[model samples]
Target: MEIVLYIAALVAAIGFLVLCVSLAMTLTSLKKTLNEVSGTMSGLEGQLQGVTRETTELLHKTNELASDIQSKSEKLNSVVDAVKNVGESVNGLNTSVRRITSSVANEVEKNEEKISQVIQWSNVVLEIRNKWKERKAIDEGRSGYSNFKD
Candidate 1:
């Protein structure tokens, strides 16, 4: 009976020791997995920070571009206004030219009869001068006197 009791006690102690060794190995594996997970989380955090910085920079650039576009639009508006003013000035010049042309036409219309009368008067004066020259030559030939008599 003593020998049997001793053998049973030894077997229980060996089984207990094996159980403790297995538990220690499982705990070590769990700790290693947790450390790997923590390392991956730290890398993800760093990448997220980089993405955030890029997004902020992109926003700032977009704002600057928007401001540039707005300034250009304002300048374009001034150019449009200047073009409109030029068009108005051209319209006014066209009106003035048309008015001057009409005034010239009206004056020509009013003086058409006067211009014909003046042409008739010039013809009459030319005829009178021709007659006077003929009379003077006839009188001079009859007298037979030298143009310069002493």
Candidate 2:
């Protein structure tokens, strides 16, 4: 009965030792996994900082571009205003030309009858002068002397 008790005690001790060894191995594996996780978290933190800096720079550039575009738009607006003024001036000039042309046309229409009367008077004067010259020539041939004699 003593030998059997000792054998049972020895078996219990061996089992306890094996359990302790297994627990130690599991703890070691857990520690290694925790270290890997810690390393991965640090890398993630570094990437996040890089992204933050890049985002800030991008925002600054966007603001600068926006201001530049605004300034250019202002200048373009002035140019467009100048073009509009030139177009207005051209329109005014064209209107003045049209008014003058219409006035001249009206004046010519109003004077058409007077112009025809003047032409008739001129023709009558010319015809009278021609008749007087013919009479003078006839008298000169009869008297053998002309009014144009020096």
Candidate 3:
């Protein structure tokens, strides 16, 4: 009975020691996993910082580009306004020209009969002048022939 009790005690001690060894091994493995997780977290933090800096720079550049575009758009608006003014001036000029042309056409229509009468008078005057020149030439020819005979 004494030997059996001693054997039982030794067995219990051996089981406890085995349990402690297993627990230690498990704890060591967990520690190594935690260290690896810590290293990975540090690398991720550094990458995140780099991304944040690049994002800030990009945001600044985008703002500058937007400002430049706004300025150019404002300048373009002035050019568009000038073009509109020119178009209005051209339209006014065209209207004036059309009015003048219509007035001239109306005046020409009103004077159509007078213009025809004037043309007829000018033709009659030209015919009279031609007849006088013919008479002068005939008289000169008769005088010249008489002097030649003499």
State the lDDT of candidate 2 residue by residue for 1-150, as single tens digits.
999999999999999999999999999999999999999999999999999999999999999999999999999999999999999999999999999999999998999999899999999999999999999999878777544463
* Error in Å for residue 126 of model 2: 14
Best by TM-score: 3
Model 1: ten consecutive residues of lowest lDDT: 141-150
Between prediction 2 and prediction 3, the one with superior lDDT is 3
lDDT of 1 by residue, 1-150 (tens): 999999999999899999999999999999999999999999999999999999999999999999999999999999999999999999999999999999999998999999889999999999999999999999987666655552
Please list all clashing residue pairs in model 3, or write none if there are none. Answer: none
**Residue 56 lDDT in candidate 1:** 100
The candidate maximizing lDDT is 3
Of models 1 and 2, which has the larger lDDT? 2
Top-down TM-score ranking: 3, 2, 1
Q: For candidate 3, give the lDDT of residue 137.
A: 100
lDDT of each: 0.95, 0.97, 0.99
Off by over 4 Å in 2: 1-26, 112-150
- List runs of model 1 lying over 4 Å from the truth: 1-41, 112-150
What lDDT does model 3 reach?
A: 0.99
The local lDDT score (0 to 100) that residue 119 gets in candidate 1 is 94
Q: Estimate each model's TM-score.
A: 0.47, 0.55, 0.66
Write one digit per residue (lDDT tens) for candidate 3, span 9-78: 9999999999999999999999999999999999999999999999999999999999999999999999
